[model samples]
Target: MKDVYGEAIFDFYKGDHSVVLTTHNTYGEPEEMPVEVFFRDHQDFTELENLAITSCEGKILDVGAGAGAHALFMQAFEMDVTALENSPGCIETLKHSGMEKMVNQDFYAYESKYDTLLFMMNGLGIAGKLASLPFFFSHCKKLLNSGGQIILDSSDISYLYEEGVAKPNHYFGEIQYQYEYKGKKGEWFDWLYVDSKSLVQETKELDLHTEILMTDEYDQYLARVTGF
Candidate 1:
């Protein structure tokens, strides 16, 4: 991830600052610059979508572009890119780099459109925002050019509710279809919270099509906009 704030932190740590505010030490600090709580590393970081099988190039829309990493990545490949970040602070940072074109408006209000809509960083959670999935896809479908696709990231949690894996949950509300696959014991990830059925059913309701671009024992879905 292209973390501008990270660069600042490094500068502070390497320079004359005796005190630093990292995650572990933040609570002990008297003054601290606020950070985006959701900021984290992408274990399943999205690279170039298979160009031969999927033309995820040309005009691209990267929704919820935190810190503009996706935009910078696409720019390196020479694709036309536009980012939609609701946070004013993020937009300001995106402007500083001038890596790609961007929109400060909400994705719902985005009108310029694109040939591909990218929902990297576990956009399933945002799409699964309390029945907004359908509405979100509707807007994406309307925004995409013909043959455009919606590529997003998600994981399968069905294994979590399976018979046995070693550890057990605290029995939190009817099992709730948690993510049980993919991930070494100690690695961390962004919160997408998507499983196979929910991801498929929700997108299908919006008339979009999906495909499992790349996955492992645990599932991570990259859905496409099939113009439903």
Candidate 2:
């Protein structure tokens, strides 16, 4: 892997001035999106993101911490936060941006524990597929200290389909995505966007408790899961 996504982000962070993320998804036409790295400096955030960030406590791990935005925001409050990312280029960007703590490793492979596992911006997508939820929850369980919580956000995305249209046989939240930047393309990957109902059910199956913190008009929601 050449870290195509990371390279684009790095260029943007290094003052490229014209960088944008070209994203392709299974549900829609390709779109040119602003690099999230820029959002690090914005004071206004979505209600869901604000809820997740304000709810953080103790040692926090921001998984998939692209550009270290969420981690940086939490750190501003003097919270002990670590930005965990797999991209070397993004990690370098984090360091350059003055992120105090960082881990350049895949979330699943990292063994350390935390009081709060913060996953914003549909970070739960890392679960990849509905069937992988069990393993995902189990791994997160091992990574949490007693009384710790997983605060994350995701959207229903079922609205993407028309009323008369039939959805896929499997869960509708399972999505595929590919990245393109400066005429180069990246490999496609599965990304899950679980609805709150399914998420609560899965938490029950795993002996965890879940709460829907907030939901917006766009079908996006924030949730909190805690070990029993």
**Highest TM-score model number:** 2
How much is the lDDT of residue 41 in candidate 2?
Answer: 64
**What TM-score, to 2 decimals, does candidate 1 have?**
0.62
Global fold similarity of model 2 (TM-score): 0.94
Per-residue lDDT for 127-188 in model 2, tens only? 99999999998889888998899999999988777765468778899989889988888899
What does candidate 2 score in Cα RMSD to the true structure?
1.6
Can you tell me which runs of candidate 1 are displaced by over 4 Å? 1-55, 158-192
Clashes of each: 3, 0
True-vs-predicted CA distance for residue 130, candidate 1, Å: 6.0
For candidate 1, give the lDDT: 0.55
